[model samples]
Target chain A: MIRLNRLCAGYFGKTVIQEVTMEFLPGKVTVLLGPNGSGKSTLLKASLGLLPLTGGEVLYDDVDIRRLKRRQIAQKAAFLTQSRNTPSIQALRMVLHGRFPYLTYPRHYGGQDYAIARGAMDATGSRQHENTNVSLLSGGQRQGVYLAMALAQDTRTLFMDEPTTYLDIGRQFHMMRTARSLAREGKAVVLVLHDICLALREADRVAVLQEGRLLCLGEPDAIYQSGALEQVFGVGVHRVDTPHGMQYYCVPQQVPGRIAEECQNT
Target chain B: MSSLRIFSTRRSDIIFWAGLCALTLGAAALGLWTGSVKLEPAQVLDALTGRDGTSAAARIVLYSRLPRTCAAMLAGAALAVSGAVIQTVLDNPLASPSVIGVNSGAGFAVALVCAAAPLAQRYTPLVAFGGALAGVLLVAGLSQRTGASRMTVILAGVAISAMFSAGIDTAVTLVPDAISGVTDFRIGGFTGVTMAQLAPAAGLIFVSLGIVFSLSQQMDILALGSDTAQSLGLSVGPVRITLLVLAAALAGAAVSFCGLMGFVGLIVPHTMRRLLGKGSLSLMVSSALGGAFFVTMCDLAARVLFSPFELPVGIILAFAGAPFFLWLLFKQRGGRT
Candidate 1:
């Protein structure tokens, strides 16, 4: 479990995320929701100590994150940044770097390391590109490869910012399903996504932020019923029943005196 | 903390290494034999093993040609390895010791030493190393303070290089009398080199090489952008600084006695990268072997081209390097670093 206590952080001390407190519980998929510059990414980086905290501290299972070395923090959690370099290296080599925290000095990866890296590549469906150069990979393939690296990290917690950015619609759903499965396996999975409908359908807990403050934080259903999404995003939220299961929809509100008409149940 | 291999050794890579090793040995042998007073391979071996007692040719080989060849080989290896590390870390092909002003930093220090002490020549290598380290750290610090993007680092390095060149000009102008061999030093050569001068530079280069080679995996990790490297538990800032320090030591030691020789650092590494891809281990190994071969051949050409007049090695490097670099730039179409 990771707790951000009254976290106040920003670039150059502008305080993008002001006094934000939150807990990411294990065995749950937590999604951070907000408009552009609402500080979703800032909050994540601050929590990891990648940026300096202005007011509060992050605690990992009651231990202050500041007290731990970077290697220790890495063992506790894996982070996938939205913006990353496409180095001219083999895909398998990139995945192997996930085992870096575990590597001792002189840092040679042994036979077991290769096995786990191959397993990660298999899990992410990047096995075909294992020996290929990452620079030559397509956008979607690159996303999959990066995801494989995070999976190879084998931490108890995963934090991915825009993991589906370059992914196709099918791959996006596949990634969300993978996150849900990881949560089912008793690991914490946190994501920041703009697709409200997909997030509502998948996340166990939703944290909605408006203007750098938490608009609401709770189970997805509770957050939806509280109207926080409508309040912040000015949308009409609807719940529909399908043959498969219950589905959620978001439609823009009409002009004054007009009832919301686009949202309909299946 | 489970381990994982970053790069795998393949059969082609073995062939590449073996070929480069053979070429380097052949170049070294050619360098040792074909100087002003030529000696046969057997004669050279006899001299090396102290079989020719009190012969002038043995004296010449031992005292003169041997030191010069060793100097060229060491300089080649140091600058080439240094450049490869810098290119990978900075994520730019053009960010080598000479291009980024690290060599100029060392040249500036040597110039100042020559002007200020004149007779305290033995301390120049150590002073030059200090200057080079300071130069790289200053540029890196400036870029880091502003945001450490690849472009920022390159531009900062260019600015620092210009500033150091100005410093070198001032030092040379103020104490002209003290630096009698300033021109020769400006254009690098191994003529009149001695065992005493080559000893310290060789030792420094060797130590720096050992340390950098040991950290091949770390270098590759750093080559992965900062965020990825940091999250992977690499102490990004410290590790980056340490690599740069080693690179500076290399550039400094090479320039300590050889002046600001370019191209070996800039060109040899680029050539190796083209042949061997970007794995640090392969890039570094090829750079060592390839750099030695390139410099040894260039020194041989410089010695024999104009015969007794003896062209400085830097001129031959520039004459060859400029066109090769232009072709490389064209091939990459804006430097695909």
Candidate 2:
């Protein structure tokens, strides 16, 4: 389990996540939902010890992550962010780099590393185009490769930021399903997602953020109730029970003057 | 094919690279053999092997051609490896020691040493090395604020190069006697190499290249961006700084001996990238051999093209490298959209 105690982080001098506290349970999929600039990504980065924390501490199994060496942190948790700038030629080779923590100085990949990388490719369903340049791959395909790289680390915890942002609907589902399977394998998965409906469908627990503070944290059903989401999003939310399960949808708020002007113009 | 069979298919690539190495070595040998006072292949071998027959031929081969060949080989390999490392680190094909002002900085330092102090003549390599390190640090400091954007780093390099060249011009103008020597150095050539001058620079280049080769795998990881590198447990900052220093040292050592020698660093690694697959080991080795071959050939062309009088090898390299670079740019552009 990864736990954050009153963690505060920011860029330069200004704090973005202000004394926010949260914990990620092992073998569970936790979805973080927040509006733009609410520090979801910052929180994820802080947990990885990528961004320096101004106060408080982050712990993995009660051991402080900050006190651990960088390689040790990598061994315990693997992080994936949206903006990957890897060169095209180095795509699959980069996936193999996840084994770096295990190797000594003057590191070289051995047979075991290759085996793990191959297994990751298979698990993420990215084995087919392993040799293709990453830049030539579609957005969804590239995400799959990145997911494979994170999986290749073989950490107990995985953190992703907006992993499905540029993906098509089908690919989005495919990625979410992969995340779900990873959770089923007893890995703690923390994801910062923009899509509320998808988060409701996939996440075991949902943590709602407003203005860099945790507003609600509970099971998906409790967090997805009408008033909870309505208050969080500042809009009307409708909870409908279908044959499959409980479904939550946001009702659009009509702006009177803008619609009237558009109608007149049309 | 079985997986083992498939793996064995890369044998041809190895053979092809080995063939290129052989071809380049042959060219270097031919260069050493044929000159203004040409020696037969047998006489050249005798001269090289320290056999008695023609003392004059031995003098020409050992004193004139041998140092020049060694200088060309060392400079070429060093520059090519420097270019490849810079390109990989910056993730920009345009990033080279020459293009990014590292060479110009060393040249400027040499010019300064020549102008201000008599001791500069005795310690050219040290001055050049200091200047190269300073140039790399300056460029890194200037470009890092913008998060080391590829264009920003290249542009900063161009600006630093221009500034250093201007400084060199002013210094050379003040001391008219130093003008010709500094000018020759700036344009880059191997006309004035002696064994005494070649040994120190060659040693530095070899040591730095060894360092670069040792870190080649980490460099491959870093070619992917910082986040990816960090997630893989490679510290990005230290690795980048180490590569920058390595590239600067190699370029500095080359400039100290052979002046600027612009295009080998820019062209050889790029050419090798296309010929060999982009594996770091293959690229590093091929780049070294290809660079040596290129400079040796260019120096030979410079010697023969002007026969009794020699032109700076830099001119010939620029003449060849510029067009090839333009062709590559156009090819990349055409492929992009």
What's the CA error at residue A110 for candidate 1, in Å?
Answer: 2.5
- Candidate 1 stretches greater than 4 Å from native: A234-266, B1-9, B327-337
Model 2 chain B scores worst on lDDT over the 10 consecutive residues at: B1-10
Give lDDT tens digits, candidate 2, residues B217-304: 7887787677777877888889999998888889888888888778788899888877655457778888888999999998899889
lDDT tens readout by residue for model 1, B242-294: 89999999999999878888878889988887676646777787898888888
> What lDDT tens digits, residue by residue, belong to model 1 across residues A1-266?
89989888899969999878899999999999998899999888877778888888899888998898999888888888898776667788889988999998667888988999999888888988887778789878887788888888898889999887777899999999989988998989999998888888899999999888877899888998899888787779898989967798888876453444334321
Clashing pairs in 1: A102-B1
For the second chain of model 1, what is the TM-score against the true structure's chain B?
A: 0.92
Residue B243 C-alpha lDDT in model 2? 90
The candidate that wins on TM-score is 2
Worst 10 residues of 2 chain A by lDDT: A85-94
TM-score, B chain alone, candidates in order: 0.92, 0.94
**Candidate 2: where is the Cα deviation over 4 Å?**
A88-92, A130-138, A226-251, A255-266, B1-9, B328-337
**For candidate 1, what is the TM-score?**
0.91
DockQ of each: 0.48, 0.51
